[model samples]
Target chain A: MRITCPICGERDRREFYYVGDAVALERPDADAPPEAWHGYIHLRDNPCGVTRDLWYHEQGCAAWLVVTRNTATHEVLGVALASDEKGEAR
Target chain B: MVELAPKSPLAGLVPVTVGRMTLTEVDLGRLTSVAPYRGRDEGLSEALKAAHGIAAPEPGRVTGRVAARASGRDEACAIWFGQRMFLLAGADPDPALAQYAALSDQSDGWACARIQGRGATQVLARLTPIDLRPAAFRRGHTARTELQHMAASITRLGEDDYLILVFRALAGTLVQDVRQAMQGVAARGGG
Candidate 1:
């Protein structure tokens, strides 16, 4: 698979280190209940359709990216820098 | 008293030639990694231009020269290394640059090599996954990618000349990998 890095353009998948689930970014507050922390740390939906995940361009630009892809078709729908996504989330 | 002499990583290795291609070690002089502070990209570019006569290069590109010899004023160049980072090679960086960016000395951290001549692209093709076609990766284009499982920075300096930089500790491996690729290409009568 090829990932198009915003800064470095397109690169092979081998250049990236996959970090499962973009939802990992939404960390629960330190004072949150045990169930919330447990869900954040161990539980996953593991959906079969469209999924968003994190990927680090370890051997390339070293940028964290959020890749929106379809698990069924393996088609990459979109990609954005994680920093940019956080800024927009705010 | 004992005198300490600076030795290159590839101290005893000589340049290798296969077919029409040659792989030679290069001394990039003082290497400095420049990372502009947040929202200071413009300031850093201006400071670099004023101090070194070159601006921060665009992503995947390089500005200035990569000289064959480290001597002379024309040896300095700014190569875009990764996101928001540039490698200032072949000359000493100006102290004034510090106000706009973080400068870290990397003079001895990397070993550089130049691969040139016909079929140079083929030699690299065997090692890297990036597209090396001249139309896609023109002169001054650079990429931080894997070179046969080793992290490497590759820059195209001329039509058939490329500059490769890898960790200093992997100098021998880099040479060995490139030599084997060179031989493979030559054996196929590609060069």
Candidate 2:
């Protein structure tokens, strides 16, 4: 699979490291209850269809990318820099 | 007291020529990595221009002369290394740049080699996954990618010339890998 890195353009999958979900960005506040923190840290939905995840461009631009892709077909829908996405999230 | 001497990473390695391609160690003097602080890109660019007469290059591009002269400080170049990072090579960086960017001396951390000749692309194609076709990667284009499992910075200096940089410790490995590819290209009559 090829990932289009926002800074480095399209690169082979070998250059990227798959970090688990984009949900990792939504961290619970420090004052949150243990259950809330536990769920945030341990629970993840393994959807078969379209999903948003994080990918690190380890060998290219070193940019963390939020990649939207289909797990069933392995089709990449879109890619954006995590920094840009975090700004939009705010 | 013990005397110390500086030796080049590829000191004992001679330039290799295979078919139309030649791989030679290039002396890229005073490599400095410059990373602009947040919201300081323009400020850094302006400072770089005033001091070195070169501007910070856009993503995947290079600015100024990539060639090195024996005169030491006559030529310099800025190669966009990665996201918001640039490598100033072939000249000493001016102190003024530090006001807008984080400057780190990288002269002893990396080794550079030049691949020049008619078949340079063909030889590189065997090692890297990046598309080296002139239409895709034009002159002044650069990429930080894997050169046969080793992290390297590859830049196009001309139509048939490329500059490859790797960690100083891996200089021997880089030459070996490139030489093998050159030999392969030559054997296939592609070079």
Candidate 3:
């Protein structure tokens, strides 16, 4: 899989460090119970198909990216940093 | 019998390889200095020692922070390899019998770290453009970079000597590419 970071130019698949799912669930109120926090932290959907997730160019310019890739094939579909994708719907 | 084909553009280049040592990658959240440590010999042993404690020998790779030394008499730019203390020096590098010097020529003498003190030639065949001639990078001098796939800071410690720190994530594939380059060079020889 390949990711094109704005700063580091285009890099092969290895340069990026993968995070879990990109569309993280919204946080509940700060006063919410521990279960809510645990659910956010631990409980994750182990989907096998395509998933939009977070990836970081750790070796390059340190850019946070929201990349659309197929989990089965790891074929990157698209990439955009969280800040860049902020407020835009996928 | 088929006549042996001559070496192509890849002849004389050494492929640099790495052992899968989990290095502490810099937090990509912000711009941080990734320099590791720099010293003569004693100082290097103290700061850039093996993180996992396995003798930190040659043919291995380590990625540490790089920054200017706070107080020292040597260099300002440096990277920490396994156990050796390397300071980026002037330009030039000794490559394998093949072509490896084409990787970099601009910022060539950047001595960041010494991942593998000895047996550096075994892995250098993976990537690099400098030729690993014994006289060129003989135990001290540095290698000049021509091109790199990752955002890397490479230093040639000696003849067939190399120390490099590429981003951690690409670690796996970079090895594969280097191996391929080596194969290409070897094949040109007769593979």
Residue B184, candidate 3: Cα error in Å is 9.7
Preferred candidate (lDDT higher): 1 or 3: 1
**Alpha-carbon lDDT, every model:** 0.89, 0.88, 0.43
TM per candidate: 0.95, 0.95, 0.36
User: Which residue window of length 10 is worst by lDDT in model 2 chain B?
Assistant: B65-74
Please rank every candidate by DockQ, starting with the best: 1, 2, 3
- Candidate 3: CAPRI quality band: incorrect
Worst 10 residues of 1 chain B by lDDT: B66-75
DockQ of model 2 vs. true complex: 0.85
Tens-place lDDT per residue, model 1, B143-189, is 99999989999999888789899999999999999999999999999
Candidate 2 or 1, higher lDDT? 1
Docking class for candidate 2: high
Model 1 lDDT, residue A62, Cα: 89
lDDT, candidate 2, at B141: 93
Which candidate number maximizes DockQ?
1
Q: Report per-candidate DockQ.
A: 0.90, 0.85, 0.05
